[model samples]
Target: MLSLIYARSLDYCIGKAGQVPWHLPDEFAHFKRTTRHHVVIMGRRTYEDHDTLLPDRVNIVVTTALAYRAAEGVLLAHSFEEALALARGADREIFVVGGVRLFERSFPLAQRVYETVVHTTVPDGDTFVPRFDFSGFRQEILERHPTDSRHAFSFEVSSYERVE
Candidate 1:
């Protein structure tokens, strides 16, 4: 099963253009630590924005076209199915990360979601979180931290698991 992880502002917005404003070191560290040996899937745009091959993780980039060449430590797939195929033998959980179009396409296949809700809004955002109907899922508040000197807003780390 697929899993998603992302952070959204209070207004449910994830990015303004193609970037997240806040520093999410803690979140990144947690992800790296937990999914070090897993395959992480993301859209071409998300891969371009980050531009680095993460150590100890398999980076899979999904695109509609095969024009782009895969980097030394990265793999390219023309579709989600192909990406999953490339990750078939991996024994770790597959983590689907951002770029809204990718999230929309992959959400239904996701068994769980880890989200950080930032208690603030970006009035001029162009990207947003998917509207999830959580009727069949159980949500747990994993952690809540008040924003202080490092960030302008407080946020909560939450985990959602599908009941069925």
Candidate 2:
């Protein structure tokens, strides 16, 4: 299965100054649990921002530069199609965990999307998650967590499957 896992704000902002502006450990944990042991494809920036190989999962970094070499256990792909091809061989859930470009490119091809809709917005971000119409997706609310001292914003983890 091809899945896109991400967290975005009310206005679809996903990043601020090349990074996620919020620090919600629960949401991060949810991300890890969802994509664990899967093939994760991400843009070079997102991979770099992560600063390490995601454990227990195949990390595929998409970059245009021919000289780009990732760390050990990381695969390099020049295009989104190439990444998907590599991921298909894994025979596991393929998760697109990205910067803006990768998410935009893979949205159409994804069979499922696990998204955390943060109940706030960051107007300064240059990276935004593309708006997806839920009409074509069967939406299910997996869980909703209220904000606390650790979590600054209230959010819900929603599962969306393509209605085919």
Candidate 3:
């Protein structure tokens, strides 16, 4: 199964100028726990912004540049379809880790969405996870944490499963 995992603010903002808008250790830890053993597909920008490949997962980068080459152990694809094809037959869920473009294209292809919704907003954010209509999916709140010194905003880890 392909699951799109991400964190977004209440305004649907996911990034600001190529970086996550805030520092939230708890959310980062949650993301690590959820996607550690899975395949992660990201766009070229996301791959570049991360600087290093996430440890313990097969990292797949979708890029259109012919001359693009990533670090060792990272697979590169020219399209979202190709990325998914490369991940085919994996026993575990493949996570569509993002940049806005990747998520926009892969959202329809995902069976599940694991989203952490922050209780704040980023007015200057240029990146976003597209607004979704949750009618076709059953939503569940998996985890919720209040704001603390380490976590600026309260957030909820919500999962949406496509209703069969």
What ranges in model 2 sit over 4 Å off? none
* Top TM-score hit: 2
Candidate number that wins on lDDT, 2 or 3: 2
Clash pairs for candidate 2:
none
**What is the alpha-carbon lDDT for the whole of candidate 1?**
0.81
State the lDDT of candidate 1 residue by residue for 76-142, as single tens digits.
Answer: 8888888878876566689888778778887888899888888888899888988777779899998
Worst 10 residues of 1 by lDDT: 26-35
| Candidate maximizing lDDT | 2
Instruction: Give candidate 1 misplaced runs (Cα > 4 Å).
Output: none
Task: Give the alpha carbon lDDT tens digit for every residue of 1-164 in model 3.
Answer: 98899999999999888889989999999999999988999988888887687899989999999789888898989998888888885666799989887888888878999999999999999998999777899999998899988887999999999996
Worst 10 residues of 2 by lDDT: 126-135
Candidate 3 at residue 84, lDDT?
A: 89
C-alpha lDDT score of every prediction, in listed order: 0.81, 0.89, 0.89
TM-score of each: 0.91, 0.96, 0.95
Better of 1 and 2 by lDDT: 2
